[model samples]
Target chain A: MPEKRQMHLGQQLTRAGRWSRAGITSGPAALWLGIFLALPLAAILAISFLTRGEYGGVELPFTFDSYKRLAGFGELGFDSLYPVVLGRSLALGMATAVLCLAAALPLAFFIARLSEKYKGAALTLVVIPFWTNLLIRTYAWQILFSPNRWLTVAAHSLGIGTAGEALYPGTLAVLTGMVCDFLPFMVLPLYASVEKMDWTLAEAAADLGADRWRVFRHALLPQIWPGLGAGFILVFLPATGQFVIPDLLGGAKTAMLGNVIQQQFASSRDWPFGSAIAAVALLLVLVGLAIFQRKGSKHEVLP
Target chain B: MKINTPLLNRHFCAVVFSAFLFAGAAQAEKSTLNLFIWSEYIDPQIVSAFEKQFDCKVNIDLYEDVDSMLAKIQGGGAGLYDVVVPSDNLVPVMMKQNLLAPLRHENIPNLKNLGEKFVSPAYDSKNRFTVAYQWGTVGLLARKTAGQPLPDSWACIFDPAKSAGSFMLIDSVRDQVGAALKYQGHSVNSIIPSELKAARDLCIAAKSRSVGFDGSVGVKNKILAKTAQVGIVYSGEGVRAMVDDTNTTYIIPKEGSVIWVDNLAVLAKAPHRDLAEKFLNFILDARIGAQLSAYTQFATPNQAARAFIKPLDLENHAIYPLPEVTDRLEFLNDLGFKLRLYDEVWTQIKTR
Candidate 1:
């Protein structure tokens, strides 16, 4: 009788746990992800295999010419396009990632060390810039960099003419905007992980006569590895597909992959080519995710 | 589980009810008119007047670019918009796709108010389904010089050494190509590759010199700002700029320029045909036509409206281009599938 009662109680607890987890599942969030992400991705994939209409829209006939064109299968200098665009995108994404990581790390650490009462306020400061539209901010940068603007006047006064010219509408402005926009994405996860850390191990290292550097290296470093890894992935994913910054801040000289794909569909009306480029961008993102997952697992597992 | 059962049922029922309501509303709207056009081109006063006069709802949506408007129409969302404003070149394509309703002249008496000069063009012969709203030519808007010669040819603007990073060209393929063709003393509609190649070469040579490719409005603003000494822009917009700030002067190039006309056409499947016709009639009234021109600062095709304006406004050579200037202009035609070729060349020039 006693054993049977214990089994029934265990079953009830298990059911209650399952119910609680299911209750936390937000219907609106799931629906939003379904409609926006999954539906659009499926539509793009479907359109990519179709032939181009005479007027440059999608036709029903299935063809692989777009992918073949991207591969530069038969044409002269066609193959060069893939590597050129891919190289530029990769360089930009990598630079943005490094900038974001560097800018976010110290800020996140300071937030983690703050009292719980002040932590939210400190974190909110990092996120306030994101509330404003990215395009508006980019345009503001444009205004500041224009020859007629006061920034130019100041630059001339300081003998920084070349730097000011380089700062306005191209690589530098884009990097600045990317770092500003995505730094919060890097910081939040890191703060959460760092705040939840067990400090007892660090104390034990110190009790054993280890110096502060040694204690940090042996005890503190290992715990925060996962957070750093997560922050890196969070910042890297969206930065890879960054569009507005490059379009607004980056001048005509710097055409990112996002700009090219946008032109292919919007102005050029070349769907197959656009889809082919979009497919490449998707594949790059997925590969990045896979690598991040692998790295996370390698560091996180404590056999 | 028991506690949440009603909640789950309520959520499901709410979703089902909302879906049904949306579906019903979509089907119920059988008389709505959807007009998609350029932003700031059409006056809200005109739309409201038509709505009040016709006793029908007027749905006006705006787009930033004409190409984007064409994309939406072509993207199988034709049901989303009933009326669309397309430039002269796109009308034939729209007609070929059977997207337009044949204009019934008897229903629209204001069609007669348009000048004879606008009745026929290269894009649509016989003015089948289109009614000309406003017509303008791409020409040189030069600054008044104390001593320097006023450039009468496109060459002075396209010259690399003289005009690099200082001149403004129209931000469009057809217009840009036309400018290059005009500079070379060739017809704007020349589809000949050798001539096109020459145009492309000229465009490439002018790239380093160009401040940027800008639209008519931007070109006008640049001229007013005195940032751009010369710009290739529509005559009407340039005239408005000159009126706002008197330092600007406009002239049609002696070689040639492209004339562009924006036409108003009703869609074949327009849900609110009665309202659309009423709007057309309202724009056709000479007094209303003059009012619209005043609001939008665009040239009016209504001959009667010209008589109503002051001498200063009428005598502005940019707005009322002289007979010889009008004769020298050519209207752009539908390049058909050759649009892709032109786009590719333009993209290469712009990007490289």
Candidate 2:
């Protein structure tokens, strides 16, 4: 009986030790997320309800004027400016994600099919652009696309653009910049999924009389959906809030949601309004993530 | 295992002694002054010379515009910086907001070297809170096309029919709206709703024809690259572009424009107030002032620095305008609450 009691006490101590170890390992990450993410988000929510001070600071009195202003109801009559900006941002983001996916799908598959040595080299080449600053790269594009440059001359000769006209500061230039900036984000994750794919399953689907498109849809796509979802989120979220690409390439003729929020904070000095915009953007992103997750889980339950 | 009390006490004593030593070293390295100013406005050589003379390190931070600078200062950056450079119009706004500290004239003996016109400027009477650093006028930078005459008035850019080739509007709210107001023969600082509405309409009409809004420096680059034929730019940027390419010219429109002055002032809650005052005095020195003007190619407000300036630069009308040009220039004033009218107008213009 005494021996049994000793073993039980030892087991209890071991269980407590395991619990303490787990707590110690996760403590720092939890603290980091609490301080950096959760606290700032809470602060933004609080500031969105506060009133703007006379000198561009926050005041104690709370009001919903910022939200009202965002909804097209300002001191002036109702206007569709803010809503238009939001819609434009959404369109830009969707276009960028779709373009990235289209370009990345084939490239990722090609990389996955390469020899082991070539695969590493190809991945490195894909990520090499990140070593240089994004601003410098964008400026390089401006130089290349200038009216007097050889590329523009070739484009003009090929009847792609008007004679003596630069191919930048337009929608085409903005789209080009956005796609180039985000392609690697899509390609990396998609490549991971493609590399782990089983060819036997695809062949079996084909042998079962499934056509090319049907095989991909029934067999290959479900396996890679997780990585595709991740890559889509990675590209879409940042592309929506991207300010520099549009400002530089689109010539600032139109303001995106990112630009509007930035102007409120940096130029207008309206913290409350900026916070309101940020809060709304965060809510939109969360809702999108929720819907995506629900769809992804439903796919997982299949087969 | 037996506890070693004496060994643990020795280890604790050694750690405490090292901590004290580190604290002393940190105290010894505390002689740094933080300066926040506009990008490309100050010469690096001048900053290094000041550091050498004072035997202390200087930390520099750059900003692109007045609004961003003010936002940073108001966002709990009060004590983080020792000095700031705010535009003349913003000096009054900052003063009213209690963002600037009063100047201790005794520490800045070089104030006497400033030109008579700038000594007691409207923004800070009797030089109470700020000192003039560099001043320039908003104007047009136009390329010299073969058969087209140079633009002489703001109407050339404001009127779509008269505007030639691809042009760029200034990306600043006050300057852009002011250009339209001046084109209509109204005050650049007009707060009247009807006048502002007319200005907004004019800008929207021009925007349809122009390339789009960009900073003065960006406009200068566009002119140099031959991407644009005309752009609304500051005098300094225009001068720089002309120096780069002789075919470009800077002109102050006949309809008049805004003259702006950037001032160096200490922050209200500065960590190094005395050091900041010394730095200001050093910058105001005659030779240093000339070097600064030469570097930035902007007009100097220092009377004593004239003798030190290069002969060609002193004679350049683009750098230092003639009396006739000066007569047509108006300084931007602090419009107080009326400033919101300009913001509203700018929003409408940008949205359209």
Please report the candidate that would top lDDT against the real structure: 2
> lDDT tens digits, residues B1-352, model 1?
9989999999999999999999898756535568888887777888777767665677789986767777777777576776778888778877877888887777888777888777765677777788778777888787777777778788776775454235776766788888899888888877776777778778877765655566777677766766568888877677777778776777788888988788888887776666676667678788888877776666788887777756666676777778888888888776655555565456446555
For model 2, the superposed segments whose C-alpha errors exceed 4 Å read A1-25, A301-303, B1-30, B335-338
Candidate 1 residue runs with Cα over 4 Å from true position: A1-39, A71-83, A148-150, A156-159, A162-167, A197-240, A301-303, B1-33, B140-152, B168-170, B186-198, B219-229
**lDDT by residue (tens digit), candidate 2, B242-334:** 999999999999989999999999999999999999998998999999999999999999999998999999999998999999998998886
Where is model 2 chain B poorest over a 10-residue stretch in terms of lDDT?
A: B336-345
Q: Report interface Cα RMSD per prediction.
A: 3.7, 2.0
Candidate 1 backbone collisions, by pair: B164-B209, B165-B209
The 10-residue segment with the lowest total lDDT in model 2 chain A = A1-10
Clashes (backbone N, CA, C under 3 Å), per candidate, total 2, 0
Q: Tell me the DockQ of each model, to 2 decimals.
A: 0.21, 0.40
